[model samples]
Target: MQPVVHLAVGYLCYAAYTRLHHGREPADLPALVAVFAAGLADLIDKPLDAAGVVPVGRTIGHSLLFVIPLVLLVWIVASRRDRRLLGVAFAIGYLSHVATDIPWHVFSGDFDELGFLLWPVTEMPAYTGVKPLGTVAGIEITTLWLEAVILVAAVACWWMDGRPGVGLFRPSHRA
Candidate 1:
């Protein structure tokens, strides 16, 4: 559940950041910026997670209402089209995370060890005990996995976007 949620959010954030701020072409600033924003969101998660029911790291923070309105505000204030795209994609991707993550985890396996994905209806991870660690752990399983996922997604996006001279998170290479 944590894996799916964060991975999707990270990829979406990267997509939004890359498309919106960095330009549909390529740039590193937005990727790093989104990572920073996600980190900040994680920090906010510490105080916002409410038994993962009302909302948690991937629920509210990753929610469309939260991420979209936020990006819209930035788009309005900064007049950044790229950032706006990122915001939109970020919102969609984040929500998609929940859509794919929660329901699947909730109904996937035995979930005896992890079932908070259902929330309200069923709880097995003991709330705080399964309260996601990647955002906080930084290099732990959740973070590492999400990092890889987002990296792959971003690179794939760049490739598919038809931009040239870019390898991945790195700058363009004409050589």
Candidate 2:
């Protein structure tokens, strides 16, 4: 899945969770936190892979192994901080990204490609295959169309939800 899709899905998940659990929309901080969480893995994975420090793009950050410790750590700290929902939002966003990727590879008939999900426990061969869209220097029509559809869906969903705004650049004054 692309970054925009991941972000949209993550935000949507958080919004749904909030609406169901709290009977209201999410606040700015948690919503932004979820969006950042969704794209966080890619921020780490892409850099390391491009630098040749990792054999595969989906190594550490994209693994269940990675999620376990981080989630536990966040849980402990957030519980102590009395911010448990923030932790849940983080996990939800992060896991949403992972979840989206799995079905994509599976649907694309790349079952063996999912071995990278195990990271260190599973040795991932260096991926020499052409990327879905190489870079901004060139564009792939298929990926462009897919991204366009996702962008529209994400915007539509957000709009339907009254456009929950996550004021990431502003401070939250919650008690």
Candidate 3:
């Protein structure tokens, strides 16, 4: 999935979680953290692959082996700090990212694409092609439309949720 889609889905997940669990819009810090966590896998893996430090773009960071432990550590630390919701938000975002990357292949019965989830225990399939970045020629029109729809939904939900995270960017009123 595209970064924007990942972020949108992450926010949607966070919004749903907060609404279901707390009966309100998502809080600012958790919302921001969830969005950042949504991109964290690509941020870790893409740079490593680009630098030739890793053989594939979806290996280590995309692995359940890595993410589960990392998220558990985050949860442990956050819980100790009395901020367990932040850990839950991170889990929602990061896990949703991993889920989005795999579901297309899973739904299509292309199990080979799922080997990355196990990392060293099961190698990632070789990169088939360069992922399209802002290019129409390399992307299917349906995917572009889907991404647009998801982004619009996310924006609409955020608006309806009263734009929870925006307050973090405003200048403080403290004298």
Candidate 4:
């Protein structure tokens, strides 16, 4: 999925999860943080390769082994403060990104290519078939549908939130 779509989907997921579990929406700043953080793995991979470092793309960030521990560590350290909300928000976004990639991998007939989900336990060449790299124009119907869903969710969430402007950066003032 595209970076913007990942962010949109992450926002929708965090909003829905918080609303359902806590009977309240996540704060705007944390919600936005979650959206960006959701795509952090994909964003980090490219630079790692260019720097002559181990190709971490699709390997380290996408790994459940890595994500789970990272999220857990944040959750644990933030257990005493409101920062826990931020941790949960980040986790929601990160995990949702991982979940959304499954169908893309499967549709691309590269289900086995998702060794990154396993991380250190498995080693395989990270496939780039589903991503638009170079002249490849890697496009798929599943990805299109997912993007549409993200758009719709973003619009719906905006409407539900009263279409706030700067208010989106703050927690809801409502009880």
Candidate 5:
């Protein structure tokens, strides 16, 4: 999935989680963390792959090997800080990113593309020449439409949530 799609889906997931768990709009800090975490995989992988530090774009960052321990650590630390929701938000974002990448290959029965999930245990598949910011494999038109729908839904949901995290970027007015 594209970065924007990942971000929108992450926010949508977090927003729904907050509504279910807290019965309110997402809190600012957790929402922000979720958004950042949504892009964290690509942020880590793409740079290393582009720099030739890793053989493939999805290796460690896309692996359950990495994310499981990382999420657990985050959960432990956040629990100690009494901010477990932050950890949950991060997990939702990160896991959602990995999840979003799976369905295309699954539907097409191209399981090898998912070898990245196991990392060194399974060889990283050869690069498919699909640009990260460009078209997805196999179903470009459907993916584009899906991304558009997700973006629209995310914006509508955020608006309904009273645009919760937007305040984090603006200076607060204190009298």
Candidate 6:
């Protein structure tokens, strides 16, 4: 999926969540921002793909290094009310990027000696093969899909939060 798609999906989904939880009102400004930004990150995959830095359908984007710290930082800075939702949204949106890229390629369990590079999905075991990019099982792997979902999600967040805006940039949401 693309950023536009992710944003749209995220917005619709977030809207549903807002309606269910806090009525038609907004959720949180920061949460929306984080989710939106996370969706934006999906764009990076294109360059990586064209460059062949990693296999198209591999564990390239499935990393906790960045999102984990981001969540922790937001939690530390934000108030109690905002921290939980904000962190969760950001993580989900970020991972949404990974979810979108599942169907594009086949996941082989073949990895390098260090187990970092899993190129040969065919040789790998049963669990080794994974849908690298797509909405399958709610995991993202493509920039387009994640970005599209997050973009929509951010809009929903803005609608729900209804307050001093977090920022003017509402890209997409995912994960």
The candidate that achieves the highest TM-score relative to the unseen native structure: 5
Cα shift from native, residue 149, model 1 (Å): 7.0
Candidate 1 lDDT over residue span 43-161, tens digit each: 44445565554443433453444556665665565445545544444444444443444433343343543333343344434333232333444543433454456557756765675
Clashing pairs for predicted structure model 3, backbone only: none
- lDDT per residue (tens digit) for residues 99-161 in model 2: 877765554566677777887887766543422533454755444466568778877877776
Tens-place lDDT per residue, model 5, 12-79, is: 99998988888889988888888889889999999999999989898888999998999899989999
State the lDDT of candidate 4 residue by residue for 16-110, as single tens digits: 88789889766666776687778887777657756756455676777888888887877787666758877888888888888877777666677
Query: Which wins on lDDT, candidate 1 or candidate 6?
Result: 6
Task: Give lDDT tens digits, candidate 3, residues 1-175.
Answer: 7778899999999999999999999999999999889989999999999999988888898999999999999999999999999999999999989988876565445678788899979978875432323346775454446678989999999999989789999999987
Models ranked on TM-score: 5, 3, 2, 4, 6, 1
TM-score of predicted model 5? 0.89
- After superposition, the stretches of candidate 5 with alpha carbons farther than 4 Å from their true spots are 127-140
Model 3 whole-model lDDT (C-alpha atoms) = 0.86
* Lowest lDDT block of 10, candidate 4: 131-140
- Output the lDDT of residue 131, model 1: 26
Predicted structure 2: clash tally? 0
- Candidates' lDDT values, in order? 0.46, 0.77, 0.86, 0.73, 0.84, 0.48
| Local error of candidate 3 at residue 152 (angstroms) | 1.5
Could you report the Cα RMSD, in angstroms, for every candidate shown? Answer: 9.7, 5.3, 4.0, 5.5, 3.8, 10.0
Off by over 4 Å in 4: 131-142, 162-175
My TM-score estimates for the predictions, one after another, are 0.39, 0.80, 0.88, 0.76, 0.89, 0.45
Measured with C-alpha atoms, the lDDT of residue 23 in candidate 2 is: 95
List residue ranges in candidate 1 displaced over 4 A.
Answer: 1-9, 12-25, 37-41, 48-65, 80-103, 109-175
The 10 consecutive residues of candidate 1 with the worst lDDT sum are 126-135
